[model samples]
Target chain A: MTEQRILHGADMLTERGRAEWDAAGVQVSALVDNPYKKDFPLLATKPSLAFLDSAATAQRPAVVLDAQRNFYESMNANALRGLYKLSVEATEAINASRAHVARFLGLTDADARDIIFCRNASEALNIVASSYGGSVLAAGDEVCITIMEHHSNLIPWQQVCERAGAKLVYMYVGEDGVLTEEEMRAKIGPKTKVVSAAHVSNVLGVENDIKLLASIAHEFGAVMVVDGAQSVPHLQVNVRDLDVDFFAFSAHKAFGPLGIGVLWGRHELLEAMPPFLTGGEMIDSVTEQAAVWAPTPEKFEAGTQDAAGIFALDAALTYMEGVGYEAIQMRESALVHTCMHRLADLDFVRIIGPADPALHHGVISFNVCGIHPHDVSSILDMDNVAIRAGHHCAQPLLAHLGIESCCRASLAFYNDSADIDKLISGLQHVWSMFHGD
Target chain B: MGEGIYNAALMEHNAHPDYKYEMENPTHTHEGVNPSCGDDIILSLRVVDGIVEEAAFTGSGCAVSQASADIMADLITEEPVEEVKRLCELFLAMIRGEACEEELEDLGEAAELKSIALMPARVKCAELGWRTALTIIEEEL
Candidate 1:
């Protein structure tokens, strides 16, 4: 067994959780065969493909597709408008999906109406920046974010701060690509009003201690907003345990259908902010003079929602719960360990992210010394291995590291050791093509 | 070696580029950047009496960009500035999948890159250096 499997087994060996694991028959081992791939229909069609770009977006499972198809087949009607049977059933299914999604994130309080659905993580972050950050930020206020944030999270804050004449501050990572506590304290000061960052960096694949960051932000009277697009899919997240003010993620990255995302915020803060969009069902009362907006969640979601995607997201959460996060971690850690060790043996390969493979949950970024990353990926594509190569929308971080671009190989639970071997072999082919001088 | 994009001629130019260096006191110079992939190229020409006496380039990019720039530098040396511009326009047309009527004997090894038209994503990479050279003569001169 790998160290990750041992550690995972130890966490679940307690008397109470042991019974749950036993009842579920969850196998606590570094996955050798990729048992979860059978559920993902995309892999079945492309049998020869070695997909290493899960960080961009993951392949959807069959259950998620079936749920979406079933919604369109049976409950195909506009929700919240009609009183007929099909419309009512569609509305009920959507509402039930909302409840299920909330429960998946450990937001179980019946009275807490904190979940608001949107298009993707980008739109969700925009809601917080425009609606919440726009209303509160002013000339002297500062919005603090990390340098490793995706463009989606960074640009929205820049727009809001530029409009309000507030300062945009960045907490930078060190040479090892890990954000330290000392840097956080130095960057986040008394003037900080909103502290936003990624729970797990998309390129670096290193998880930040958001719980500690939230505590520190609270000490400075700043609200914490987390981009959980990369973190929530691979790890077990309890929103209440982190005590964050707002959290956002996408469904497509977590083996669900696309066009569905979520923004979860505390009820009081959400109620204090104005609506992000205003139309049809989002209005309580409308007149020629002025309009009264609806409640917290409905006020943020104005137009017609993607009901089919929401239903599929509910199925995705259920599927993840069935496989469990522990197994997911063990499987990915083994693959990372295998791939990183092989990559490290090559003299020309320079690995990014942390030194320890444990720190890199499922993503690893690397660069060949004399070869451009785009060339590396192009050669690898000929071998049917898909990887991402570019600045990866984190151009600021790449500039800080003094690199133009790099190649990234990210993993999902459906991946196994064979995928890692193919990635290594493909990289060798890239070397042979470029380094035969 | 795989046969499609990284052929032997392209790889030879990229491996040991004769003109891949900065020139001293060039008549014209231009830098081009591809923001999509962050590939950059600097084209420098030593022109004398309306002719390119010597040509050299310095930059970093993919195999396509580097090889195309090196081959373009070798072709433009000792040619008239007007002829260099014509060759650049012809090369751009070839990479854009247009029909080539002119005999590109002056282009030398660069004519072999006509197959680059099939790889649409890399057309910009192969054209960066030629475009930079054209920009220098058209605007700077």
Candidate 2:
């Protein structure tokens, strides 16, 4: 058992901590922590901590921070309403942000107006479920999704199907942690109206073939929507190349600010759907009895906008591009490879996803045998190693796997071999604590 | 080892607990779930003639929840129902670190759990059984 400390000292990276980390192989000179860690202020200041919960939310870089402050300091106004110069500047800033987000999603056929800003990815999904799904779905019609979907994507379609008297169908995966083509063909048939699934499972850490799914759905004349909350942060997603009708992701998960999200739909689709929320600025013309809605993006973005967050999201996309997708992909894959191998070496640990280490993209979920995930996470916390415990918001997948919950250690480009080493020592500490050393 | 939440006593109760079993013909039974962590418990109590004749739980949860439930069953069984309810309240307070020295002494084996207060995230884990027991009693009234 670890000796109980009477006091939690501040400034964790002391002389002794440096010595201890060195002894634990955390300070290997040839293999150091990422050069990008300094870009994120929290990682730079804390130094010794290993933050492994990037799937929930990522650390924002200094450029994103500066963009948020610059928005507030320079042009702080309700966008698209006033005739003043500051209001126009705010509107232009948001417009610029919309263009940037559209390009980030590779909106080749669509322009800035097709990009809608909601509170988060959940809200964006709800908009599609309420507006397009509510209009298209009818009795006996079916909506198809995978068994491995986050609650955000699942619940919206569920409620819409229930309200429209439509059937909700789920496609299942085999032991390999991916959906097969035959399964997709069998589930999405002529009765399917809409198809929605996560581009990558939050728990399984397997990237679903969105392009294949889109082509299959199109064969049956079903429109496709994608939950890119996990994919956008790790992989390069081109919505046009995939040909999905609508895609959604949260800004916070993409190393941007909170309280803002992106929902990019094809231009014609966005133009055809009715407004999701109606209020002050979304009106093109208004009367006491009736009203007219503004265009596609404005019709969805009702009420006051988070102009600062939008501006910050633009900067986040820029920062990610500056790092380049190829570099981010390479670094994260190497980190996950190292992380999974080290965790698999532990006798008590059981990796939940595919056996092949290359299959895991940027996330990995595992269980500590005979130990509760919460207990495992609690012990790891003592070592300043953070991990996510619980269902990872995918209860259906966990239930299918016959486990209550598991601990997830997701990675980003900023993590390195040092974090993996810390996690290895942390799990060993946990197992030794439960079963005497 | 004695100061932390995972003390020898708690670990013993978690590994080989006397209170983790099914109770047939239980007088009061209720299921409780901690939605945050997905920890759940099916608390069964056999209260007869104003005394808790037996108390048992059939469920799965973390070590803190399981051990805490077992220790609570050990303290409250064969005791008056009113005293059981009182001890449940005190156990909750002790887990929150709200009990003084005198009140802590009254809790017996459960008092060793006062160190759980240091972990704000696991506080709910320690209180799961006590909260389930309290709910059963309150529903009876």
Candidate 3:
């Protein structure tokens, strides 16, 4: 058997093209199977490997990897711990990363002081839900969110509402998988104490009207918290302009290292809100009887930080800035648009979310009639076409659609038209195998 | 994939299901679902003269699950009532790849699915039909 190479920029549906892609995808998988890279090695060794599961985790580039390595190799000290050169360097790196993230979100240095680092966006949301729910939420108040939230965004609020006497209210998304501004306004009223929503739904990919929602929440004196996990990675976000009281996102989703998250709160609000986690780094001074906490970001940080991961995140943001967020967004949007057109034309295939590309970002979920999502996913995998299957951690949305699961192919700036072609070809093969076409 | 893992004839039966719709007057019917992967199966059975006269199934899931149910139906229909119960036991053992020589003979092509043991995620899919059959038999008894 001759070893085959999948040619880049080739139409994947052609016989030679598909074989090449399959070979390439397998090659990439083999490369990723090894764990001793010590650097940002391709998750899969093969450049031709088709990985369509960006919704789960985006692949990190070499720049992000080098940043983390450089940090550990040089200034590997606890931030704010000592006056030594290494410690000062580590502290400066931490502050610089914070500033980079703040500028990326269009927040000032003072606003950056309110951005606390956590484990992931899920933990960031939990910090607000647990801390704010404990201090601010009273009996009879309602927390408003939409139907299309991941369990991470939903469960914490549910727990908070259960602990306090507060109620959890959800604004319903229409059949098109979009929540109307009117629907949001109706759901948020004087009783609504907090309004939290995903800026772009992880499953549907429909970008919500956050600025309008923020205004409505403000009208009712409720704090608006936006889950930027899906949005921050794909689009250029200006939290200051949107006026969201708190914003949360994961660095890994934006091609950064894992185990690092950002929780951006208003400076005054963070000062007033109690810290959820109490530990060494977050304290101002500790006495036998009483302890005062540090201000804003430090107060919320609580423990020794993920210094290396934070530095890597700053590198990730720098890469995005060099590429230009607008350009990345446009490229991904084009890829998604092409995917929607190709998949929607297939018989028995139904795209799951809003049909308008202008209304959404780069995520697409769909189901092939008479074919289980698992079957579709496995067949695609056999051809090295990676995609996500299941409810995507949004069970309520899946239940609403009367479907248990759907296959999702999410894209990033690194992906191009060739990826979409591979996905279409894989789906065609699955359709033929099932229907004997 | 091992031939001993799942009955090839059974998988074929699943792919080309014979009695896949509702039985006109089923003696009993049971719905089983795998919550983890969201596979659902509804098994309908008609027993006559202490034997399963007919078995039909309707559901949505992966090919392994849907096909497994079809194979299970083909194996037990029109067999002795006690024999059907014994066959169910053998099928469960086969899924676990624990069927002895004698037990393998009873399971027939269903034994070919032994490779399913290696793919733990597909175990529930392969057993969905068999589980429903057991539920129906237990309900009748």
Best model number under TM-score: 2
lDDT of 2: 0.87
Q: Estimate every model's Cα lDDT from 0 to 1.
A: 0.85, 0.87, 0.81
Among residues 3 or more apart in sequence or in different chains, the pairs in candidate 2 whose N, CA or C atoms overlap within 3 Å are: none
In the range A1-437, model 2's lDDT, one tens digit per residue, is 35432112222233543443444344433235478999999999987788999999999999999999998899998888889999999999999999988888876324888999999999999999999999999999999999999999999999999999999999998766889999999999999999999998899889998999999999999999999999999989888899999999999999999999889887788888998888878889999999988888898988999999999999999999999998787677656765666676678999997876567778899999989999988888888889999998898888888888999999988987677767877887888778877
- Is candidate 1 or 2 superior in DockQ? 2
lDDT of 1 by residue, A38-135 (tens): 89888877877889999899999999999999999999899988999999998888888888877878887463368899999999999999999999
Give candidate 2 regions above 4 Å deviation.
Answer: A1-31, A108-110, B1-3
Q: What's the candidate order when arranged by decreasing lDDT?
A: 2, 1, 3
Candidate 3 per-residue lDDT over residues A1-437, each given as its tens digit: 01232332333234433343344333223222323222235744654557788778888888898999999999899888988999999999999999888988997766679778999999999999999866888899999999999999999999999888999999989878888988987899999999999999989999989999999999999999999999988888999899899999999999899999999988888888888999899888999988899988899888899999999999999988877876676566555655676676676798888877556677899999878887788677666778988889999988988889998988876776556656776787777666554
Ranking by TM-score: 2, 1, 3
Give the candidates in order of DockQ, highest first: 2, 1, 3
Model 1 error, position B138 (Å): 3.6
RMSD of 2: 5.0
Q: In DockQ terms, which candidate is top?
A: 2
Ten residues in a row with the worst lDDT in model 3 chain A?
A30-39
How accurate locally is residue A301 in candidate 1, as Cα lDDT from 0 to 100? Answer: 87
